[model samples]
Target: MTGFEDEIRRRLLSAQDTGRIEGLLFHSTAEPIVGRLHGDGLDVLWTARDPWVSAQYIPNAGSEILLARPDDWRLKDRVAPTKHDVLYALACEMSGKECCDVEWDWDGRAKSWRVPDGWPTYGDVVGHIEDHYGYVANSNGVYYVRESAGVVMPADWQIEGQVFVALDDGLHFKDVRRSGEPDLTEREYYDGYAFEQAMAQGYDGVIINDHCQADDYGNVPHLSFGLNAIGREKVEWLALPAVRRHLDPWYSGEAILTPDLDEWLADFEMEAVHAL
Candidate 1:
């Protein structure tokens, strides 16, 4: 066992004697001594063997503290865990820590906590399709065709009608008279359209798959979403419990003796609680 594992084991035993630890959670790579923390006043509520296991069971385990080890996959290659962030955020919230609030940099080697760039945006939905083809506007509706495909203006085209203008490889709609200018009407239109569609379907927000390769390197293709104004309000309302729990002193990292196991742990720890 590494010295860090020994330190964790020692702290677990010390916390057990003082009753500071009520439950424990660890990654599958953790040593047997870590598991020994259980069965003696400390209930081992979870042993995260895989991402799915952690997602399915960790929320149900009301562990007072979490001690996670790095996953085996992360050690082999530094693949980005796109899907795991939500689960980690959920876990952090469950353990009374606010997710993405602080910059968690452990030992200067792990990814820090921040809103991921993978989150979808309006451009990803209606943007151009590389250098070859893009969306163009007409009376019939928008259609994806070869760039500058010699599209003749429709008979009904008017000065006030919507027109497509390409800027930064994104399709932007504008008033026919202002086609030469780049403005934000396209974003407003799409965001409003997405909001309406989601509301009509009784959803709080819209999840979109980004085909534009906008995600961080090594991340798998993942679904991303944005909450409309009303959806954001509803989420904030529902998250009051988590916010309060994060503020509760009882859930603070004071009881976890190892500084590395505290709330300061970075985003990479989501897979394995221990630093690699």
Candidate 2:
């Protein structure tokens, strides 16, 4: 067996001693290489959680070996847009729209857009004059426009129903739905999607890089195991120095450990001592 396969076998045997061994899930392309795990009395499957395999023994296994990269996991979290993002979105909305050329009235204290005598002026107005642009509330509200531009009146200037909602601070805006989640990198997204699918079906952790692949892809070698809370507890031997030395060489630098796993590993040394 290859050195990589030998390392995987050693870890799997240790996991089996703790009763944490379940079937191994790998890409079909890796079938020939990892088929030896089956001879050790462990189940081995190459379907890698294909829907048809959902009812098979792999899904309900407490902790199965999944051949994958942790960095490829694509979980998403929601975040608020920055002030610049809101401004850019607003500018994009107004880039080429035309508005009426209105006049501005200076009341000594502040200057405001003055609609034509017969024009209805009840809502907010946002426009640019020559090279300057800004937002102005109704006649009774505040004006934040910059100096000098051909003022144009928007017949029905309304922004509330669109992409942005003015924040309580009045000067800032956020997404109307406030549900804008940043997109994940393509590989991360698909990886996360597949991991989630496996988790939903009851698998608890992944054994990364247990298969053979060319090393020219520029990905740092990450040969660690990643476990959810339950899997970590079940496969505690994974924390051993002997096991970790084989896995940790490129883990921190290249693998994107999930927040939960990161926290668990941070405190695991103490936890393991206490368990002893």
Clashes of 1: 5
**Which stretch of 10 consecutive residues in model 2 shows the poorest summed lDDT?**
161-170
Stretches of candidate 1 exceeding 4 Å from the true structure = 1-192, 200-202, 211-220, 237-262, 265-276
lDDT string for model 2 (132-159, tens) is 3333343443343321122222322211
TM-score against native, each model? 0.18, 0.18
Worst 10 residues of 1 by lDDT: 236-245
| True lDDT of residue 273, candidate 1 | 54
Write model 1 residue lDDT over 8-108, tens digit each, in one string. Answer: 44545555367463222222112223112221111111122111111221121122122133333433332222332422333333335332533435544
